[model samples]
Target: MTKHEDQRLRIIDRRTLWNGFINLEQITLEQMMSDGSTARLVREVHDHGRAATILLFDPERQMVVLVRQLRLPVFLQGESGYLIEAPAGLLDGEAPEVAICREAMEETGYHIESALHLFDAYMSPGSITERTSFFLGRIDTSKKVAPGGGLAHEGEDIEVLEIPFEEAIAMIRTGEVCDAKTIMLLQWAMLNRAALSG
Candidate 1:
């Protein structure tokens, strides 16, 4: 094994606990203690694959486009199922930029002119095996290629909202926009305001 692989944690075996649209894998593992002892543990990990999210910014209009859709799991927990988030989707083997652009068009009806890659993050590393690539893409009102509401087959009834950047940021403090990726990109945009305006 490589030097990095010689860690204190070792995987004895791993098996799929549930496999479907999303997969769950249960792992049997052991970790060397601080005092040189070993402890075995079992962990169940949910694999949703990698994803990409893009915040479509219309600098000329000083607005950002976001999507609100029903997220059943979130709804089941007693809160509203509808969530406001940046246009995002699983990579499906595509490059991060390509996937984000495609998702932007599909969910927001806006064709991105240029995309600036921001960063990648694991949204829920404790249980999920999904790392999402974040991006900022420029767009204009004229970039609307279609009346996008997401794919019908995918059961996505998305409501696209184009709100002023300032208001979008304010929504974060009001707890109106709670999606982590959206909050990250919005904060980044606020911090990079000068660059965004030509």
Candidate 2:
């Protein structure tokens, strides 16, 4: 094992609690404490695998391509279920770049030939094991090839929105853009606007 894997924690037991669309596992582990003592803990983990997301920017028009879709989780929280988000989806065994490009095309109708990888992040580290890869892809709205509303068979009824970059940023403050991956990509765009123009 690598040095990082040689940690003070040892798994005492691990069992699957639920095995549905998303797997839930119950873990029991022991951790060495600061005073050379050990502590036992039990925790549940949700595993849905990794995902990827991309922010499509039109530098010349100073606009961005986003999608709005119903999110049951958000609706359950007493907020609007329709969420504005960057084009994103699960990797599903594909590479991050390949997955994001496919998702972008399916969700935004913009065929992303190449995407600049930004970073990877864990949206909910406490209990979920979903690490999302983020990317930035330049696009031309006029060049859209398909009427992207997502794959009909997948039950995706996404609404494509092409908003000015500035206005999209404003939506963040207005609570219209609440998706974590989307927000991170927008913030990254804000910080790297100059580079994007090229």
Show model 2 residue runs off by greater than 4 Å. Answer: 1-4
How high is the CA lDDT of each candidate model?
0.90, 0.93
Backbone clashes, candidate 1: 0
Task: Give lDDT tens digits, candidate 1, residues 1-198.
Answer: 884597898999999989997899999999999999999999999999999998888889999999999988989988898999999999999999988888888998888866788889999999898999988888886678889899999988999999999999999999899989999989988898986765
Model 2 — which ten-residue stretch has the worst lDDT?
1-10
Clash counts for all predictions: 0, 0
Q: In order, what is each prediction's RMSD in angstroms?
A: 1.6, 1.3
lDDT of 2: 0.93
Best by lDDT: 2
lDDT of 2 by residue, 58-143 (tens): 99899999999999999999988999999999999999999999999999899999999989999999999999999999999889
